[model samples]
Each structure stands twice: as C-alpha cells, then as structure tokens.
Target: MNDLRSWRVPLPQTAVKCAATVVLAALAVLSTGDPQLVFLAGIAALGAGALALRDLLAPVRLTADAEGLTVVSGYAGKRRVPWPDVTAVRVDERQRLLMRTRLLEIETRDDLHLLSTFDLGEDVRDVEAELLRLSARD
Candidate 1:
C-alpha cells in the first residue's frame, strides 16, 4: 500500500521573493559607491532568498514499505529510518510528523522525512487510530 501525497507551507515563495527584493533594493540605495559592502550584503540577501526558494520548491513525502519509513524533502534531502531506530512519531505544531531517529528534535526541524498528508485531512481520526495501533505493536 503506497500512500503518496503532499502539503504546502503558506506563501513560502511570495514572502521570500518580496523580502529578497526589498533587501536588494535597500542595499542598492545604501550602497552609494561602496562596492565591497554592497557586494557582501547582496550575497547575504541572495543566500536567504535561495533558502526560501528552496523551501518553497521542496517536496515533503512520507512513504512506508517492507523496509521502513522514508522522508523526502529538499532541506533534509532523502532519508530512510528503519523501524527499530524510530523512537517516536507525532504531528508537529506545523502539522508535519515529527520523527525521532535519534536525539529528539535537536538535529532538524525540516519535515524532510515527512509522510504524505494527501488524504489525511478527511480521515484524521482513522489515521490516528491506525498510528496508535501500529505504535502499540511496536
């Protein structure tokens, strides 16, 4: 049974693009004739813009199989967590499942390893029940 789906964060790209544009514009105005400072600020702004763009484009996927759990997101890239290594899994404040493969959320907060939320909204209770049942078995 392959459950494939996707969820999106709100206005990820728009906000990023707007902020980047504003920063670049500001840098341009303040730059005057200082090439070095302008260059550095421009680079920083571009980097932030790139990160935001990445988040906007990245896909978060959750897949289960005979092997185990897999989370695919642009930030964390692709990761597979064997069932044994999974300590706990729960939906986070952002609605993404938080998977603990090791030392809790200390490592990453990106939902790269997220399971798909495609049809979860319509069957939340059933899904929770299923998760509880599976967790108990483990």
Candidate 2:
C-alpha cells in the first residue's frame, strides 16, 4: 500500500449477504401466497437489494488516499473526510457468539465510523495499520 496513491476496498462478503437476504425474501414471497408475507418480502428484497446494488455496481466500500478517506453513504453517494479531520484510527475487538469480532474505528472531529471485516474485506488491524501509515504521511 506504500506506493499506491489510493485504495478502494470492496465489501464482497457483505454484498453476498445482502444478495442472500434478497433471495431468501423472494423465496418466502413465493412459498407463501399470503398478501402480508408477499408485501413484507417485497420490501425486504427491494431494500436489501438496492443497498447491495450500490456496492456491486461500484464495488467499493471504502476509499483512502493522500488527501482523505471516502466511504459509501446514502443510496449511491459518498462521504468524504479530510485527513486533518481524522482524530484517531484504531481496531476494536469484542466477544460475540462464542467468537471474536474486530472492527476498525475511524474517529473524526465529529463522528465515529466503525467498519467490520465484512465491510472492509480485510483484517481490521491491517487496515488500521495502513491507515495509521497514511495519516503519518499526512
């Protein structure tokens, strides 16, 4: 990552989960002809599919560069954070369901963004280290 001017990390596993949600919801709609079930499933499929579509279409969950970090926001928009605004970058780990979960925490002047392995498709520690390096260069 040293020579790279920018890094765009994709959420492949999260996209797969979203796609699975859509498929499962659609199956539920088909299996049960109930109007309520159909309506609920339709909502689920559309909502989940639309979000995942943004990732699948652009294939980017997060982006980092010399200037700042960019992350997916809204339906198809991006939120940018300048390097100066970033206050801290760290990896947080916790126990969940008999396993450990790790996430990268990006603290800005006014906000805190936590990204999981599913969201980054990379180990949080590695991402944090890379981010720290970039910030140091800044």
Cα lDDT listed for each candidate: 0.49, 0.72
Q: Per-residue alpha-carbon lDDT of model 1 for 1-138, expressed as tens digits?
A: 533332333354447565885788589669979988788877877777765655555433344444455555346465766555655555433333675322112013333233323312223334434443543444
Worst 10 residues of 1 by lDDT: 100-109
lDDT of model 2 at position 57: 62
Q: Write the per-residue lDDT of candidate 2 for residues 1-138, one digit (tens) a residue.
A: 433333344556555758777686867668675877777777777777775766666556567876788866655567899889989898889998899988888888988787777667678788888777776754
Per-model TM against the reference: 0.43, 0.73
TM-score of 2: 0.73
Q: After superposition, how far is residue 125 of candidate 1 from its true place, in Å?
A: 16
Considering every candidate listed, which one attains the maximal lDDT? Answer: 2
Clashes of each: 2, 0
Candidate 1 pairs with clashing backbones: 62-115, 71-113
